[model samples]
Target: MSSQRYELVFSEGPGTGEDTVVVAPTGLAGPGGHPVYEDATGIVRAEISDRGEVRVLATGGGQNAVRVVRVRPLP
Candidate 1:
């Protein structure tokens, strides 16, 4: 098997603004429509919905399950 590098950034949020998080992924990049893995922080994966809502998944970084969170910008 081969190893690839990826960065996960948490761009905007209530208090997460100006907070550009960088994470080096040890796994492959997740494809769209595919499920995501969750982390201990209750954030398994993040995706933007068709309605422009950011969905977050919560996984314990172990199991194959994921939690989802929705985020959107307010006007």
Candidate 2:
């Protein structure tokens, strides 16, 4: 089985701004070398760029929570 790694980022807590997390991918990219996503959880949102950039959007209710997801291809 070929395993892959992904990066995650989110906003946690008040004034926390942006947080980061990493997740291992279960499957490879679908096409175009773009990251593939199956499912997402929590207030986490994922974004990817053709320039090999990943961005996540997660906002905490001024409490201090963070979650982020990023997907990338491996060589």
Candidate 3:
């Protein structure tokens, strides 16, 4: 596995919609053409690519307090 610094970003909905942006430091090509954030339990979340794009695959936790947890990449 490779590691590098990354930026996990979240943007809440305005009066219309909600979106998110994830910036990877090293521009690593992850699963499904875009980057992927996988947790310890092998749970993977959608990730943005080097380009600014957003894609939602899982049913997010809802419009409450959306959690945007950032983990320090192992060296």
Candidate 4:
């Protein structure tokens, strides 16, 4: 398993303006062949494309925003 991590930034969603969530690779791929990531609670699942396109598959309890403005790699 890779130790790669990512920061998912959400805009105009549940929390305050531009909420950022940290996610790690799930070692699984989505239907579009993109890597899937989930929050610590395993509720928010998203498939982020190479070009920084985020497709949210599942939101823990509808707490995630549909629009993810930015995705950045973590050091």
Candidate 5:
């Protein structure tokens, strides 16, 4: 459990969108041992690879093409 925090910016288009805060070394891990994080509402889950690739695992209900476009470190 790392103390580092990160901001995951989600978008459905070409602009900024919803943001979620995730702590490093989350409880889950994806393929290749990447870190996985979920939104507070549990409506979105994403796996971020070491190369910064974001893979959306689940979108609770909506079938929109939601994706994580940016990841920023938080203090």
Candidate 6:
């Protein structure tokens, strides 16, 4: 499996530090190249796209807000 870091940016939505990023089960990958479904980050969730692009989802406080996912290249 492989590992990668992704930057979860809140483009449009509630103020900063208002929303939560939760881990969803979009059949994406994670730090390792494994089947990712969900995580225990409360409302803060994240997932990996098929192309290995990390897509984080914000929920709870900022669940209805828009999120910007940035995939960090392997170092």
Candidate number of the best TM-score: 4
Off by over 4 Å in 2: 1-3, 12-14, 28-33, 37-50, 55-75
Model 3 TM-score (2 dp): 0.31
lDDT of 2 by residue, 38-66 (tens): 32443443344455465433335554433
Worst 10 residues of 5 by lDDT: 1-10
**Model 5: per-residue Cα lDDT over 12-68, one tens digit each:** 666556755563545888875777866666666667776667777755556666666
Indicate whether candidate 4 or candidate 5 has the larger TM-score: 4
Error of 5 at 31 (Å): 3.4
1 versus 3: better TM-score goes to: 3
State the lDDT of candidate 6 residue by residue for 1-75, as single tens digits.
234333344446455553323333545545656545344554545566556555444546535635553433232
lDDT of 3 by residue, 1-75 (tens): 234433344445445444433333324344567665533333334454445343433535553554443333344
The whole-model lDDT of each prediction reads 0.35, 0.44, 0.42, 0.78, 0.65, 0.47
TM-scores of the candidates are: 0.27, 0.32, 0.31, 0.76, 0.61, 0.36
Over 6-70, each residue of candidate 1 has an lDDT whose tens digit, in order, gives 12345444555443222222233344552233333434454443343434544455654322223
C-alpha RMSD values across all candidates: 9.8, 7.6, 7.9, 3.9, 3.5, 6.9
lDDT of 2 at 28: 42
Candidate 2 vs. true structure, TM-score: 0.32
- After TM-score superposition, the amount by which residue 26's alpha carbon in candidate 3 deviates from its true location, in angstroms, is 14
lDDT score, candidate 5: 0.65
The clash count for each model shown is 8, 5, 0, 0, 0, 12
Per-residue C-alpha lDDT of model 4 across residues 1-75, encoded as one tens digit per residue: 233788888787666588789988898888889999888988778887777777877654546445887888887
